[model samples]
Target: MSREFLPGQVIVYPYLWAWQHERGETEGRKTRSTSVVVAVRGANDGLTHLALLAITTQPPEPDRIALEVSDIECRRAGLSDFKRCWIVVDEYNYDVAERSWYIEPDEPALGRFSKAFMMRIAAAFGQASRKSGRRVNRTE
Candidate 1:
């Protein structure tokens, strides 16, 4: 597995959302651009754990938390096709790099967000995580 699990890196993934899983869906309905918000290697398992946030052109639902992506930031993140978009922060898809069947190791990343913008995203994610946030485990 040669995929780079770095913060801010955007990659295409079949991201199963918490709600979808709750509905007994085993896979994402579609492949979409997802941001690698966090990546930590477990000492015992030696696997890279990843937290992926979905990137969408549609605005988030009223109850969900999100951060708007600017034109420059979108371009930097290889999202120029989206004139407007937001990063959903209220929840994430969790996966182990070594065990994941959805993340393609040979695929190239779409792009990366700037450190500053990523910091903002991280902060929002942290805050949302402390609230009614949800996680969808893709490993199962």
Candidate 2:
């Protein structure tokens, strides 16, 4: 994890840990990619767990949902270019905050999406859950 973020928020992150417990964990380089914070749960062990839904500039695939954000919103969120994003609702990941180098809250933040957008995300998540026949947990 390269950047720390709260649940329900959005951020322009630069890398992905690409962790696969079966294979191993491989880290991504410093590259910008958009991700939605799904949760920040605290374990009984006192470690914070982070989950995120990764969004991308790539076109929406079969199960992915498109997210609409305005130009001003994109700029405010620290995107390097125009908005061309989609959500990968079928998949998500979790890690510890200690593994992240999060942009401080005081920094120019990418903040959470609007209520409307969040509602859409939640709805998409539900649909995805049904499509895959798995319960979608850890929603914000």
Candidate 3:
């Protein structure tokens, strides 16, 4: 809650909390969720907020549009052992916490998507939003 979050940064948060509230289900315990920050801005109340897309090692569903991240990029973003990763572009959350991010090595916010890749993500998000009438939602 005290640190700043930037777009393109990879972060993990207490997704079990949201899952519990939204679906009343989790893996029988708290589990963290990883996402890539897409945007950051100050809100009316003067709080910093973030927009993010879910990241996963799992192969995305056929209906989902995803960007492939290389192993080097994955390591830079606090993920390792995976030679590749995917960032889902169809849906994302907005106005989430600016802090409480997690990394396995406790490294200094090392996970970040490259500027070029981030631009691609933004473009994809725009296309999907325009076609599907989807908008980023503030985290609950």
Candidate 4:
């Protein structure tokens, strides 16, 4: 059975898109590549968080992958704080049919995976959205 998730909740799915950049070159050669989504964060603040697994051919193994989260993504995922907040995937479109992919799944394993994925995405979102020096007031 499928699961249900509320808005501002995180969701993680396999990455199905990739491309290349032609702006800069490394070591006098341009490199093209693709990436995958290992995790995603749901945003209560009005955005979605995505953590990408970047693959490259360098000193590290060609199969080696790195995980990275972008600031723009965090902003898009509506991340504001780092604790106790839920991460929701952004699947709302005014023109397209509204599909609910965040619902609670009947499968316990799937549910756990989804929740774990959301948590990871939330962590990434928090990292990207966290203020450098300012601390949030806890008493307020």
lDDT of all predictions:
0.92, 0.52, 0.60, 0.28
C-alpha lDDT (0 to 100) for residue 45 of candidate 4: 34
lDDT of 3 by residue, 1-140 (tens): 55666667876643332334356453224333355545455556565665567676779778777788777778767778666678777666555454323323343464777787778878887787677523334443
Which consecutive 10 residues in model 1 have the weakest lDDT in total? Answer: 1-10
lDDT of 4 by residue, 1-140 (tens): 23333323333332221211123221212221212123233355332332322222233323322233244433334332322222222111111001323212342211122344445644553454353211111111
Which regions in candidate 3 have their CA more than 4 angstroms from the true location?
A: 15-33, 98-110, 133-138
Q: Tell me the tens digit of each residue's lDDT in model 2 across 1-140.
A: 34445545665454453333224434434545445545554667555565566666777655445555556545544553755565566555544555455433344345566566666767776676577522222221
Per-candidate TM-scores read 0.97, 0.60, 0.70, 0.22
Ten-residue stretch with the least lDDT total in model 4: 89-98
Q: Give me the overall lDDT of model 3.
A: 0.60
Q: Indicate which candidate wins on TM-score.
A: 1
List candidate 4 stretches off by more than 4 Å. Answer: 1-3, 6-14, 18-97, 100-109, 113-120, 129-140
Report the C-alpha lDDT of model 1 over 1-140, residue by residue, as the tens digit: 76668999999999888898899999999999999999999999888999999998888889889999999999998999998999999999999988989988788989999999999999999999999789998988
Error of 4 at 132 (Å): 16
Better of 3 and 4 by lDDT: 3
Index of the highest-lDDT prediction: 1
Ranking by lDDT: 1, 3, 2, 4
Count of residue pairs whose backbone atoms collide, per candidate: 0, 1, 1, 24
Which runs of model 2 end up more than 4 angstroms from their true locations?
A: 1-4, 14-25, 63-76, 101-108, 133-140
